[model samples]
Target: METAALNPVELEIARNRLESISEEVGTALIQTSYSPNIKDRRDCSAGIYGPDGMLISQAEHIPLHLGLMPTMIKNALATYGADRLVEGDVLITNNPYLGGSHLPDMCVITPVFWQDELIAVVANMAHHVDVGGITPGSMATHATEIFQEGVRVPPVKLFSQGTLRQELLSVMLANIRTQDKTRGDIMAQVAANRLGERRIHELLEEWGAERFAQSTHALVGYAARRTRAAIEQLPDGTGTFTDSLEHDGNQQRDVAITVTVEVSGDELFVDFIATDDQVDGAVNCSWAVTEGCVAYVIKLLTDPTLPSNAGLMEPISVTTREGSLVAAKFPAPVANGNIQTSQRIVDALLGAFHEFAPEQVPAASSGSMSIMTIGGFDETTGQYFSYVETYGGGQGAMPDQDGASAIHTHMTNTRNTPCEVIEREYPLRVEAYQIAENTGGDGRYRGGDGLIRHLTLTRGKAQVVAGTSRVTTAPWGLAGGADGKPGSVIRHGPDGDEHRESMTRFEVQAGEGITIQTAGGGGYGSSPAAE
Candidate 1:
């Protein structure tokens, strides 16, 4: 038998170059971005893709963004052909229906060509504080439609033939809340994309564009095969689970999520046939976002060595009704559904797996995106700034041990921005940034605890927004283990009274302190191993 041979030395170097582009792009964005979200919080991802838009590599950034790149690339190519895309022309979009997670997550993609031939595309996506709509932060729980959610930009050319699109820039700046921050962030994305294009061209010159493209395809397929092998290990049947969100960010009813996961010889199928239809609030998620969430869950338990690509998803089939929470339909506000809905799905699936494979599954992790948004005047510069902080909590203890504390759910791989950086960047003062003691649910093998973040508006006024879950229905423990604690957001109100809101976006006076407590992870099986 003859074996196909690939140069191991050249392949490793090409892979390194592919991933390094993201690192460079991340560093450039962090250094130049005007908002604390990008600078301090690092809510961004960068990647390099083949001209076909198949993701070749990524910097270890947000798994959501990384996993969804191929879809976005496919959409872009469908809209703009390779011949139409030219040098220095950049494309931007944030339409979930087209291929986006939310209304606020702005994605910029630029194609790279060498000697008039397409080589690759440099892509980057970041969370903009505001993109214009009824809400200041572009994420209101009451959003009923895509228009109400925020400005939705189809795949438009932000730059064409190496020239800036002044009209689009002006319109974007006017529609958004913070003009300075939004404009600056947009430019930052352009620069990072340019950087990636340059690096990719250099790679093309170094390792012949055709050869590099072949290698990318090879790498992607390798990952797909590895993922299939991982899926083959399950009990070769089906597992079912159902989870719920307390409320859909409105006075709306609770949102339910259901999954019928099938495992066969070397493939997995996750069906959301029983999930509730689209609700009236922003708690709906687009199909692209649903794919990201499912991929995250599969990756956590499956082969970590697999490259996240279309090939990886080849053996995995995911189905959901267009209007369900998992596959939010068109015109439904899905800005919040990507985060909240997906988190619950993760918890539910993990819970279901616990019954059959107790050792493979543990208790649920913090069930929400412990998010905080603070925007107001800065006393020092007398300027305005908004600081958004996303915190994580613990994963549930296993059958034999305790849960790990202060880790984000599978939805994110980002770290909490240091309090020092937060205070230094914005006018807010960090009073208490510590772990919430005794907040974890009690079990023989106790679950992990959450965090307590206290922010004082030392400035005159601040508009604060919070998006957290497990505030009512706490993280539940499994198989004889105790439950995890619930989360909350409390504000010292006008009359010195404490006001708590489930998913709040309100104003705070000078004397107010916003205290946000994150949810803990659930606990696993019985007390402990028989001593």
Candidate 2:
């Protein structure tokens, strides 16, 4: 049952079936989750992997999650060999050094067995609101090491032999800020994996076990062939480019991430050996995240329409130096790397590709995630509240079309929390929410405009932590276009004073308001054409 024997019709059917299982897993998690971040914003991802730890199919959710999941699965398999994985056993991990993006993003892996033989592993990753840290959100902006960020769970069994590990679960719940929400979200992820197992079993039953195995191989091979053909079409040469992070989250200094993209024959190589050393701040990222960024950019460049699997990455290779910004070593603070540095890696890749194909590349988008977290205790309700959300910004203009306005671009795909929901859930008032006027750069195709959000604390005191970028080094334009406006975070006291801070944590009293102006995207070309 080799891949070469499978016909095109069988391959397409098999590919769709495998992808649908992953999609169904994500749908179940979203519908059953309690938090708005997962239920409404959909910050989770699901995927199916082969028995040999190769990615088979994934849902079109978070690119960061989908890309790093395969490595996490392989690491899990390496830690506890296949002989140790039993039916109804679930493995969990969030250690960045051990194939995780960040502490808050927990990866859940469950093996599916058919006739007592391991068939596949269904896995899902969800960004929990809190996992215990100095800050309420568990994503500390000023953390100098990984220990201060959150609980770093290594590869371990969360469920064993069809029974929940109550002690382990209790330890997890005891460490986080939001116990009920975290527990509910984790259980939802568990349920999603269970559903994935059932769906995979159904798929195996429909197609004979041997046929299913052969089809999976054939589909992956087909995708690899298609990607190689696409890569062969590009010009063969080395294109080197560099991009920067606005700050290291601890100071106003910049950290550079460089990429040298080489397209030789039918294969592509991305090397990050010359990037800056890992910083002490939360801006550093793990090697898994850097690999995810490269895989995602390659997928986007070669053929986005191709089915996502290990085969798509077959013709691509990524190299990163140890302890570098793109491949930080153990103990490096990396909470913001998953959110902020991941975006810069993509930008660097795009920059490298732009050297050969400028028309195919758009100007820079709102490069930062515009992260803001507000946590405090409410006297009226006699309880505590912690709210974490990322605001959207302008998207870069394309060659022929204008960039989308006030939207999440590139790495992150989460939606902004609606003002109605924010006011209803937290002790705050939405003073104003609108698109910033004249924020987008001017060009033949104008870049998108950023958003302006004004929030006022209603009662009690609140701690605000903002980890945003693209303020000092604004999004760059191309082909003579002007750069976009820089972003800013301003604190307006109840009386009259206004203060500016880009990346810092501060306290706010009742009646104080904060204004966030997200950066706009760069334009494509300098022309006074109708936009």
Best by lDDT: 2
Per-residue alpha-carbon lDDT of model 1 for 1-531, expressed as tens digits?
122245778556656767788789877887889887887778888887767777778777887777666787778777777668888899998878766788778989889888888877888899998887766677777777888977788888999999999999898877776779889998999998888888877777887766777777766776677788888776676778888987787763577898888777898888888999888888888777777777877777765666665567888898888778777778889767756777888887776665555567778778887677777656677655667667877677776778877777677766778888777766678889888777776777788989888888876777777778888878888877767888888887777756465676778877787888888877666555522
lDDT of 2 at 443: 88
lDDT of 2 by residue, 1-531 (tens): 457577778777788889999999999999999777788778899999988788889999988888788888888788878689899899888888876888989888899999999988999999887888888787777899999988888888999988999999999888887777888999999999999999989888888778778888888888899888988977887889989887888888878899999989889998999899999889888888888888787766666786789888899899999999889998899988977899889888888988986767788888878888888668897766777788889898888888888998888888777888889888889999999877888888788999888899888898888777787778888887767788888887866756565677878898987888888988888777543
Off by over 4 Å in 2: 379-382, 495-497, 529-531
User: CA shift at 302, candidate 1, in angstroms?
Assistant: 2.0
Model 2, position 378, has a per-residue lDDT of 80
Model 1 / residue 24 / CA error / Å: 2.6
